[model samples]
Target chain A: MPIPSEHQRPTRVTAKESAFTQLQQWIIDGTLQPGEKLNDIELAEALGVSRTPIRESLQLLEVQGFVKMYPGKATQVTEVDKESINDLLPPLAAMQALSTELAAPNLDENVIIELEETNNRFAKAVQKEDYFTALKIDEDFHQIIVDQAANKYIHSIVASLQTHVRRLFFHNSIILTEKSIDEHKDIIRLLTEGNGEKAASIMRENWLRAIDEFHSKKTD
Target chain B: MPIPSEHQRPTRVTAKESAFTQLQQWIIDGTLQPGEKLNDIELAEALGVSRTPIRESLQLLEVQGFVKMYPGKATQVTEVDKESINDLLPPLAAMQALSTELAAPNLDENVIIELEETNNRFAKAVQKEDYFTALKIDEDFHQIIVDQAANKYIHSIVASLQTHVRRLFFHNSIILTEKSIDEHKDIIRLLTEGNGEKAASIMRENWLRAIDEFHSKKTD
Candidate 1:
């Protein structure tokens, strides 16, 4: 409910929120690589805003572990550690399990068809070797499960945690992408058939497989 | 590595770090209640720092979901959202469970003894009905398990997540204090007896129990 006051400026651009969004996108897009320096004045000039909003954006980024700042130092983007990625799985599995549990009861024929469509899109994207497109579609497909769980709280956390998981897998080997696509196919098949337990179990294992892939890449 | 340039006479405090820590503590201590207004100028004055560090700290807090800053309006402390907390748990649980698994091999007798000491202190604190002391001891006990796991990365995420968990449980009920101590005793006893499987299982269950207690109080 705490709305920004700097509204109603007739300009096409709102500086602060734009800065925040841009910074966040840079993080998501890996434009600003991990451990990269974020200089305030320079960034302010680049973003065409005052140092205030840029600084604010950096602080927000820091909290998400995307940026690190210390006393008397410029903040830098940071990588999620491999071990942290490994450690990130079980809870994700738990939440996904919870989601599937909830979704199972609520999922109707329409929802199943919709998820199946997304999953098919993901499969086509994978076959075309468009990993990025596959990734987004895959996200959309899984999101239905979490969304249908009807717990906004759990879904939010899963959303955030899933970002790190995706980013990790994105940077790791290509094999994970293939494995993940295959896994998605099976999960969609199970969900479409209303095999809730199998769907949930596969979803959980999918994350574990991703975790293992992450570790193998880390040591490699 | 990008250190900021300092002005004349670097004050007794590292302005940025102090603001950061103070802002975080204020949230944790409930001095800045949920949905409270956080004026940069006023908060800067109160914390005895300039707007620069205060701004930086506010941004940091914002990223972690502690504060919400509007562009022109004053930043306000954030309200607790159950969805966000549920979102927070997967990474937390994953890290804790992973740490427990890792510590299974490395939890030596001496470390178990130290954990026992911490557990005993928790019990004594509980007997004296000092919830704050009990909380500290309980945190110490868990930290040992995380430390023994030898994965600093997972440890850090788990530690950060624990802060939010602490805030929720501390404000909501006394049950975590009591249940935590009782569970800590059991966990330590099992660890000492080298029942790693049971100890880890209990540790995982402890988180679930705490979360359930939080939900119960939240609904009430």
Candidate 2:
């Protein structure tokens, strides 16, 4: 059999992937509020795409626990419950720690410099109280490490769980910002020193700190 | 506005859910081998269902990383890659550890006795070289704690990851079974003594051991 040409291979982003990304953003940013009905027709019109892609996106979101789709009923954004945050944290922390461990052995000086630059940007964003910007920069910093790790499963799980974490950070940004900057510095220092185990442990502790901060806020 | 009646709530298991479960079992058990094409018409006929549910089931399985569907082409079972296992183990172990930690405070004498009984059955299954039975019992042993923890997010993640882990165990049964039984006994003893931290730590080590065993086998 002849090898399939490059164009014959499936493209990474289709109409459905685009739709999923846009809708996921809306959900994460609270533009699509929790408990609000997702009207496929209206969404398709708004997004300038067909309803099929919108419907497919909704299905994907449902699987990610971002939406609730009732058969023969409307789909709605799922509430960001404290219980969900609690449940998501441990796995998220574990994967982050694993990613660090895997990435450490492969970290080049260039990558470490890139991470430091990203951390600088993240610190600036946090200083400016730009929680959203800080969140994205923070993700970029971690994404580089996870990508270096070359573990697709951990990458995917972390990507999904980060949406919920982003929402939590939006509220607790002020309190988490300074500490988070320090934590990132600590992690970068450990990575620079080639201390993978200590870096992984610190990464886990960083996530646990977020969880603790969330609980304190919730109780308040 | 009037509230929807009890009958209006969507039932948990629709035809799609049923098809997903059955097809998943076939995939997990190796009856439907990796790279095998999933013909919707044939599967629908075999399962005594229609093509629509089969198609939907395939989609769900694709999302869960069990199968890969190409548009206007064949849907094939996904091969369980070592990288995938490596990515999945840390998160699975973390959630299992967290489950044990959460359930420790709630473990009654009756629950401890049930766990002991399950461990006994698990040991017997291993001794008899019944890996499938041992797998199921091992799942049951950990599941009780996860259920008791009442964290739906962890529960769902664990349940999905377990499908992949189950497949791995099926191949490495003899090697894993003996070590797994001892680990379960260790976990049970810790739980009996209400040493949640130690139990969680050991649980994490138990999973890491499996990953190590998988790697050693792969290298050989």
Candidate 3:
């Protein structure tokens, strides 16, 4: 008998993992509001799957702090707290800076062109006041460097934190400032010049700036 | 009818979580070797519980990357790859350094005295060549700062990565050097002096030194 390949295996586990990812995305994009009830049955119906996968996904989400389970009661999307934002942003910034630093030496002309195109799209989205589109493009721009860094741990850490950050973006209709675009351009130039440290520093500062703006807007 | 208190409720979930933590510790301490098969029945017997909690724990352990599960087959502990160590260490160091930085201003004289006591125990454990005891004490010393930092995100991130670091300690019989102790003293001094940045920098350097030593040993 021959061994079965991975794809030949049952889809139950895959469905559960994908459901988890989908629900997480929903939470991040504000499709599922914070503190809103999450009924496994309703989610199953919406996703066109059985309740089992939704239940499994909810368990994982609870473990990841995206949801809260009340054991025999109800599961609800967790509220994105301001203190959590303050606690998480610095580490997120550090990880992004480290990613850029590691990615600097690996950048080639083709990759640089790809990044430039993404940045152009980001800028255009911002100019058009398409906050969601700009947010997606901004993620794509940073993701390129994060992928290039090739550090699974950093990647996983950032991916986990980014969900909360995205929630912040959703809750606050943050306008993309020209300063952000210029910072991106500066980062690109630094990378091109092979100045990893300066690029990393600027990337960190960029994140800090955004965080400061969020706090300022919140107070206002 | 009156509502039952949390303690009066069923203990199934708590048991499962505790079992997971126990198994993880076993893996980190090398009591469960990498690639060792995890038999639910055996684990249940050893843990003095039914196989249900063990089975649930195994599922979570699989999700956590501590164990690999094959559907309808076997579950096994994961190997500690050098590449994973390299990828994880920097982030771990950054979080620990951040913890120290945040905790510095809040470090009261009592907390400082407690830390000193822990470090003295750690040094004695090293002098006595009790690697396991030293490891435990070292964890205690750093954990104080992490707990004091009061940032659940950083605390959680460091806790997750520290499991892998402990596994590395188990796999390699790394002797605690005099330099390591001196570095701890320097961090304490900086913290006492209210120099958060310097303390954080030293803490980072201390962790980086361990990673460097591990790499050199691997090459040898």
Candidate 4:
């Protein structure tokens, strides 16, 4: 029963929401490791909420694939399925590619600047070999495009799949290389030139590359 | 508080799952109309379950965007946003296109026959002006491709989006015409030829045509 250190409850959201968000983050960040049993009573104490919200939060988490609940038994975080990357990345790649295609023709100069800034940070982190920061910044780079695409359904689906991808990366060694930095630049240039088809193809391959990297890592 | 008459307690599932599935169907089919208030106790009695499962079902439905819950007030079915069709269809179109591309190269003879047979039924339904059966058969047609693609994440996201599309169609005048029948035939023909690129393009356009049809309905 590991409790988050920054356990102060946020204001405005219902107790259940606060609990659910914190619990999900902890699970994703590996603060609450895989197969770790959760006790609603203990978590209720840790989060400064009553047991009701804790119970409610578990129900939500279970539905979202973050946790598994057994009847009259323990609730545990789901283990990272490394193999899921194979099944996961293609559809995510498809959606990200579509997002790039949509955003290409519509990117405002300011958003393009933001993407440039995020990529700069990503390159710097990768240069320093801080893969954690680089991965987060990589998400920041993609988030800019997904936000620009402005389709709620695509936005939500990307967010969920990205979380699963992040969880897997957190549990294993991420193999992002200098090659990705160049692809980001190409994606930006294509968007600037409004060459959506090429940009989208590049973006889809950019994500599918992860499956390849994971396979290489497993073989290593 | 519509207690679905068909709600004889189902066997095998956890009560919460049974409640969630039935409630979601009721909402989608308009049995539980938009903005209608839900009372958990009443739902429990109707579904022959306890209030806990009914409450759990509401939480899940709210997360899935079928309902909105207000603190200390009411949990009501979310109203259909007619404008959402504009935002919703494009990503769904993208995913379906990708599914078609993936399923194309690998579709065996028997699978091709199943697709052709499904298209024949779709055409016959249209000839009889049976829009209901036609729409359902239309789902069966696309679903085969999605299943054949064999991506779990894509499969789940497509299922969720298709439900929303179906809900919107259920409430509005679905003007699916003979043009879609021909498109389905072309899709089958192209897929049989293993021309994935052309087949995917046609599949994308086939779904996007709904947005155009929806727009025409609005102006009419």
What DockQ does candidate 4 have relative to the true complex?
0.51
For each candidate, report its DockQ versus the true two-chain complex.
0.25, 0.45, 0.45, 0.51
> What is the C-alpha RMSD, rounded to one decimal, of candidate 1?
6.3
Pick by lDDT: 1 or 2, better one: 2
TM-score of chain B of 1: 0.81
- Regions more than 4 Å wrong, model 2: A1-13, A39-52, A170-175, A215-220, B1-12, B41-51, B71-74, B82-84, B170-175, B215-220
How does residue A144 of candidate 2 score in lDDT? 90
TM-score of chain B for predicted candidate 2 = 0.86
User: Comparing 1 and 4 by DockQ, which wins?
Assistant: 4
lDDT of 2 by residue, B1-220 (tens): 6866766655566777788889998988778988899898999999899987787678778888889988766789988665566777877887888888888888889988898899899899889987678878888998988887787767777888888887656544425548888888898899889999999999989877877777777642
How much native contact recovery, as a fraction, does model 1 achieve? 0.22
A1-220 per-residue lDDT for model 4 (tens digits): 7887865634357888899989988998899999899998899999999988888899988766789888676799998888888888888998899999888878889998999999999999999999989999999999999998988889889988888888888887667889999999999998899899999999998999988888888743
Inter-residue clash pairs, candidate 3: none
lDDT per residue for candidate 3 within A61-175, as digits (tens), equals 8767889988767789999776566787888888899899889999999989988999999999989889889988888889998998998778878888777777777776555
- For every model shown, what is its TM-score relative to the native structure? 0.77, 0.86, 0.87, 0.86
CA error at residue B39 for candidate 3, angstroms: 6.0
lDDT tens per residue, model 1, B65-182: 6787776656898886654555565446555665676787777788878877888888888889877777777778888889988764456566767787667655554354567777
Query: Which wins on lDDT, candidate 3 or candidate 4?
Result: 4
Per-residue lDDT tens digits for candidate 4, residues B1-220, read 8988976634356888889999999998999999999998889999999998888889988877899888677889999888889888999999999899889878999998999999899999999999889989999999999999988778888988988988887888577799999999899999988899999999999999999889888742
* Residue range A111-181, candidate 1, lDDT tens digits: 87887678778777888988677777877877888999876546656776777666665555323366666
lDDT of 2 by residue, A1-220 (tens): 7766767676456677799999988987778887899899999999999987787788788988889988776789988665566777877887888899989899899998998899999989889987778878988988898898887667777887888787655534424558878888898899889999999999989887877776676543
In model 3 chain A, where is the ten-residue run with the lowest total lDDT? A5-14
Model 3: how far residue A60 lies from native, Å: 1.3
